[model samples]
Target: MSKRKQNLVGYLFALPWFIGFSVFLAYPLVASIYFSFCDYSVLKKPVFIGLDNYRELFADEVFWITVKNTAIYAAISLPAGMVMALGLAMLLNAKVPGTTFFRTVFFLPSLVPMVSLAVLWLWILNGEHGVLNEVLRMVGIRGPNWLGDPAWSKPALVVLGVWGVGNAVLIYLAGLQDVPTSLVEAAELDGASPWQKTRHVTIPMISPVILFNLIMGIIGTLQVFTVPYVMFPGGSPARSTYFYAMYLFDNAFLYNKMGYASALAWVIFAIILVLTGIQFLLARKWVHYEAGR
Candidate 1:
């Protein structure tokens, strides 16, 4: 084909994807920005309202509650999950029998559908006749109502978050395997204890991986929805389990406050962006790169 004709053919092939992107992703994003500044409901046209939505969001008590809940949940779950995942990965990386089987067992939970997992945990964490409580009772201890009490509800969800760190464990396992054997041998020759070798050599070598998981855990924990939503409907037990994303969803759909929801969505985007940027900034001091080193 001639050059111009070939170019035209290529454009034709790309046209479908370009159109889809403009109609779906690009347009919605732009529309959401505009809508955030207006009073909009899906059933009616958006009316420009200046900064009213944002002002209202700041004053909204429930919004603040959700923010506080989300922050606390992330603060507790993120580090705990990372530590547990790393520990499991290290254990799996050791020269132990049935390693493959154990790896599969750990990873299998992550493959379960989110709804199913939530429902399963719902049963497991029930206040009465639950497997966990049953075990506690076996040990002559009375278990607290995990989902029925506001104080324990958030912690219950944290447990679920930790349980599903299988994906993070796999990532850590890969990073662990990539550590230099020579460096470990040198540490051994220097008479470093197991903890010293791990702290001085293995962790530093996997610092980049740690940074990746930390950023991902921050994002995931901040946007937590499914399990809590399913297990604690309407953030019951006094809204202690209510999270930012769940509130956003309720505003958008249940309350039909599209404009307010859009504003909230933008705020969430900004929060994630700022936090991720902070992580990247701090990573410079700790995350090690072989090439940079």
Candidate 2:
């Protein structure tokens, strides 16, 4: 076949996805960008307000609170969850019996629906009648009002976030398996201890994967909503766990401020874009790729 015919065939094959992307993803994003500058109540028409939505966001206490809470949640969960995932992956990578069983046990939590897990945690972390509190009481430690207290709500969500580390662990495990064994053996033969070998060889080899995880973890945590949204039953006791996405949801749905919500969504998009850009800028110094070198 001629190259022109091949090109036409490829275009035909990709037609559905291209059409869907244009209609669903691209159109909504463009529409939201337009809406962000307007005031729309869904029932009525949009009136252009020029940056008023953004101007109002700066002074809105709830917006700032949601930003702070979201930042804290992302900061706490990203590194913490990634580290836990790496540790679990390392454990699973070791030669041992029942390795598959352990992997299965650790990963089972990720299989459960987020809504279901949040409901389960609500019952288990209740201030008085919680299973977690009961366990703590058995050990004579007073369990704080987890969902009721603003101090504990975000932290409790972070704890719940750890349960999702299984997905990260699975990714890290694949990376670990792909690491070059020769480098490890060479380090070992040079009288380097296991710790030294891991620090020098294992880590560097998997640095790309680490970078991948770091970026994805940051993005995922920044957009976190499910655990906090459902666990607290309306932004927690004092809006402590009210994430930016949750606030966006409230504005769009509960309050019917679609235009403002679009503005908030765009702001989130900008934040994520900046963060991902920063990660790319910094990756040059630390994220090693052997093939690239």
Candidate 3:
């Protein structure tokens, strides 16, 4: 084909994707920005309202509650999940019998659908007659009401978050496998114990992977919705389990506050952006990369 004809053909091939992007992703994002500054509902024409939505959102008690809940959940779950995943990854990386089988068993939970996982955990964490409580009773310890008590509710969700760290474990396992055997051997030659070697060598080598998982965990934990929504309907037990995303969803759908929801979404986007920037800045201190990386 001639040069111009070839260029036209290429454009034709790219047109579908360009159109889809413009219509779906780009348009919705732009529309949301406009809607955020208006008094909008699905059934009514949006009326420009300046900063009213943002002002109202800031004053909403439930908004503050959801923010606190989300922050606390992320603070607890992020580190806990990362540590658990890294530990499991290290264990799986070791040469042991049935390692593949154990890896598969551990990873299967992550493959389960989120809704199904939530329902399954719902049964396990039931205040009475749950399998966890049953096991605790067998050990002569009474298990507290996991989903019922506000004090324990967030912790229960944290347990659920930790249970689904199989994906992170796989990522960590990859990083572990990539560590330089020579470095580990040098540490051993220096009479470093396993714990010392892991602390000094393995972790530092895998710092990049740890940073990736940390950023992902922050995003996921901040937007936690489906699991908690399914397990703790309406953030019951006094809304202690209510989170930012859940509150946004309720505002948009249940309360028909699209403008407010849009504003809340923009705030969420800003928070994620700022936090991610902070992580990138702090990563310079510890996230090491090989030369030419």
> Which has the greatest TM-score?
2
Off by over 4 Å in 3: 1-11
What's the lDDT of the predicted structure labeled candidate 2? 0.91
lDDT score for residue 44 of model 1: 97
For candidate 1, the 10 contiguous residues with the lowest summed lDDT are 284-293
lDDT of each: 0.95, 0.91, 0.95
What TM-score would candidate 2 get against the native?
Answer: 0.98
- What value of lDDT does candidate 3 attain over all alpha carbons? 0.95
lDDT per residue for candidate 1 within 11-57, as digits (tens), equals 99999999999999999999999999999989999999999999999
Q: What TM-score would every model get versus the actual structure? A: 0.95, 0.98, 0.95
Candidate 1 wrongly placed segments (more than 4 Å): 1-17
**Which residue pairs in candidate 2 have backbone atoms (N, alpha carbon, C) closer than 3 angstroms, thus clashing?**
none
- Per-residue CA lDDT of model 2 for 114-170, tens digit only, reads 999999998999999999999999999999999898888888998999988999999
Candidates ranked by TM-score: 2, 3, 1
